[model samples]
Target: MGAQEDTALVRRGYEAFSAGDMDTLRELFTEDAVWHTGGTGALSGDKKGRDAILAYFGELYSRSNGSLKLTLEDVATGGRYTIGVQSGRADRDGKTLDQRTVIVFTISDDKVIEALEMAEDTAVASEFWS
Candidate 1:
């Protein structure tokens, strides 16, 4: 796919996520996709395969009681990669978490094969999620 198409696909994926469209999100990823959560915290880990990644999403939903929301600021692509700048907010246990995040996606054949997520403040995010 072209760079513009890749960015569009990534944008659509973010839209799906924000809209709680899990089916669309699933369709954007390859069957053997992997997700890397970057941080030195309990929530940091690598989830391999589409099933594992979706299960992680389930865990996040349960932890946040389905109140988490993501807002995308921008998306760009180069070669086979796409980068998304976004912010996420959620309320859990009477505490609110609002953080800026950058996610890098590796795309192949118009599908996301891998994703690596980085947060603006890992320690703060860890505390909030913990």
Candidate 2:
């Protein structure tokens, strides 16, 4: 796919994620897709496969008591790589998390094959999710 098409696909993923549409997410990612989250938090790790990635997303929702909100700021694509910038906020265990994150995605055949997540404030994110 071209850069525009790839960007659109990623935007669709962000929308699907915000809407909690797991079915759409499943369709957007490959069966062997991997998602990487950095930091020392419970949610930080390499989530292998589509099922594991979906479960990580579910954990985000459950941990935040369905209060996690993600706002997509921008998306850019080059070749098969798409980068998405977003801001997220949530409250958990009397701790408030408000952070910006950038996710670099490797797409192939119109589906995401891998995603690497980078939080703007890793220490704060780690504390919040720890």
Candidate 3:
């Protein structure tokens, strides 16, 4: 796929994720996809396989009580890689989390095969998830 197509695919993923649409997310990812979250918290680490990635997403919703919101700021692609920037906020256990994050995604066969997420403030994010 070209850069535009790759960007579109990633945008759809952000939309699906924000809407808690697991089915769409499942379709957008490869079966052996890996999602890596950077931080030293409970929610941090590599989520291998589509199932594990979905589970991590579920945990985000559960932890925030469905209050998590992600706004896609931008998407840029080069070859088979796409970079997505987003701002997010959520409330959990009386703590409020407001952050910006960037995700580098590797696409193959029109599906996401790998993702590496970088948070604006890892310490704050870790505290919120911990």
**Tens-digit lDDT string for candidate 1 (38-111):** 77667788999988888878777788999989899999888757999999998999998898999999999989
lDDT, residue 104, model 3: 99
Task: Show where candidate 3 strays beyond 4 Å.
Answer: none
**lDDT digits (tens) for residues 1-130 of candidate 2:** 8999899999999999999999999999999999999998878989999999999999999999999999999998987589999999999999899989999999999999999999999889988877
Kindly list the per-residue Cα lDDT of model 3 for residues 56-118, writing each as its tens digit: 999999999999999999998986579999999999999999999999999987999999999
Q: Is candidate 1 or candidate 3 better by TM-score?
A: 3
Alpha carbon lDDT at 116, candidate 3: 98
Per-model TM-score, in order, reads: 0.93, 0.97, 0.98
Per-prediction tally of clashes: 0, 0, 0
lDDT of 2 at 57: 95
**Clashing residue pairs, candidate 2?**
none
